[model samples]
Target chain A: MTGGSELPIASNADVVLVRQQVRSAALEVGLSLVDQTKVVTAASELARNALVYGGGGMARVEIVENGPRKGLKLVFSDEGPGIADVEQALTDGWTTGGGLGLGLSGSRRLVDEFDLVSAPSKGTTVTVTKWAR
Target chain B: MERVPILKLGDILIISIQIDLEDQSVLALQEDLAEAVVAHSARGVIIDITAVEIVDSFIGRMLATIAAMSRMLDAQTVVVGMRPAVAITLVELGLSLGGVRTALNLEKGVALLDHVRGATP
Candidate 1:
């Protein structure tokens, strides 16, 4: 991680702040316009999930490098009640919160890499990365 | 909480979202638009998002919801000025925004509304 920042997700306003922070990081990492939008949008979803589902958490934005390639990595973690089934949670149109249920699944499609970890009582953390091409 | 202003232009209401919208702002915009449509007796609503940098699921749902609400109020909603990148991201995000009409820009959006309303009555 070269240039990194951490943002707290405690309210709807924080989610917007997360998006702005991620957008700047993506731009700094030289992501194209579309890629920048994808990553920022993903950050928005994950940040909101941390606030709404996780009952507030934190977001870490980092500029990562893989050899000559550079990328943006975002990690969102929360201490709220965790998901019992990761597969069902990742499945599209499956929501426990009456939302569109696309936050997890849709965000996965927007990035190059996705990792989700959670347990019924262990809380949840989602990390996603988008590489510049 | 930023309140998105709704401008009444004839029988149409124009809402240009120029800020990074929080969830509350999105919800408030929905309510404001609904009221504007009824109050103005609007036949069409144009939502301009040219300056918006991103449209996540929440914002996407808001657009769809506003369109649905406007329809029920006898007004057509046309979302215009979506950046190309935003459009691509929206499709990949699985938010097809079905039932919500779109145009390339505000001019086309206004033209579309005129055509739809003219053809209907």
Candidate 2:
């Protein structure tokens, strides 16, 4: 198994850039375009969530092996206002701003596995994984 | 963002969306789409999203809402030119754009609308 890498995203504009990096990293790990697109989309949503809701954060992209399968994992963490109601925030159409509130919820649907950790005032972290199949 | 109306073919309206479909810019497109569908009594509408690179959940939800609204106005809406990456993202975000049609490209989208209109009449 090969080692993984981490990319930091600090600004809103960097979200898109980080997505590209994630795509490249996924490809470097031998993911096809279809799989690459999936990872990129996941990265973009998580990165955007970090920027919009978390007031900016960083994304960590890494490759890992899971018992006969290899996959990519993206972890997005932010030090902004943590979610007050994590469940409500995950619900569709629930939003604090004019947005459609699809960021976190939608991102969960695209990846093979998803996990989130957040609090009211501490911060938020989202981790997603896509397996090579 | 510039809004360019491609043409009015029959009762269907085809418009080219020349802007990044982001959280901030989707609102204008939504309003304009509503107005155009109502004013023209369009039976179908095609939106070109080739210029858009990424689509977050906010924009996806807005597009879904717009499609629903268009249906209420008696018009069917189709989103065209979704990059593979965008489609993957939308699906991952758990957004099911029910009732909204999608095509690989604008030309194909127009052709689909034509077929739909023809089948109806």
Candidate 3:
């Protein structure tokens, strides 16, 4: 996986920008429309979490090649008051906000590979990959 | 603050989200819609999202909330013109958007609003 550019997540507007970058990455790797939408949506959700929950962070994208197959990877990191319970946060119906609590688990479902790490006061980083079929 | 316009079509209020919406803009739309519904005495509402490519959980929740708000005011709501890709994304995002009504286009959406209002108590 070759790392690409990084995008900062500040406000809601940057969320749109993140989606744009994610969409372009998916297209650059020649993902189908449905696949493109999935990655873009997942990026949007995770980006929002970085801003709303993590108190703002940045996202990096990359193109990964594996001997005749290609994939897209997104890494989101934030240094804020970290999550106390990772498992509960990833639950489908768990949210500290007014949302339906589908952000973490939903994004995890969209990507082929998912990784999340957090500490009480340190921060959190989420990485996901979606491979082209 | 950038605001999406709400058009009054007889007894219905039509809101078209034609651009990428920020959090502020989405909130503004919600407030404006509530005011327009009351001002025009609208009986139905149609939100056109054909131009919307990505509806994250935030926007999806906004839509569902707006539908519920409009419903409490006795106005039927119908969402129209969701692209297939967006639909898949919404589903994958895990939001059912169950309380809202949807149609293929504005024409059918308006008709649905009328039909729903017509048969309601």
lDDT, residue B59, model 3 = 89
**Superposed model 1: Cα runs more than 4 Å off:** none
Scored against the true structure, residue A3 in model 2 reaches a CA lDDT of 54
Candidate 1 or 2, higher TM-score?
Answer: 1
For A26-116, candidate 3 gives per-residue lDDT tens digits of 9998898888888988998999999999999999989999889899999999998888999999999899977779999999988889999
Candidate 3: where is the Cα deviation over 4 Å?
none
Taking the tens digit of each residue's C-alpha lDDT, what string does model 2 give over B6-82?
45777887766665334444666678778878787888888777876666665677668877998899887889998
Ranking by DockQ: 1, 3, 2
Which candidate number has the best DockQ? 1
Strongest candidate by lDDT: 1
Residue pairs whose backbone atoms clash in candidate 3: none
Error of 3 at B25 (Å): 1.2
Better of 1 and 2 by DockQ: 1
* Model 1 residue A108 distance off true place after TM-score fit, in angstroms: 0.4
Give the range of the ten consecutive residues with the poorest summed lDDT in model 2 chain B. Answer: B17-26
Tens-digit lDDT string for candidate 1 (A104-124):
999999999999999987889
Evaluate fnat for each of the predicted models and list the values in order.
Answer: 0.93, 0.58, 0.80
- Chain B superposition TM-score per model: 0.98, 0.82, 0.97
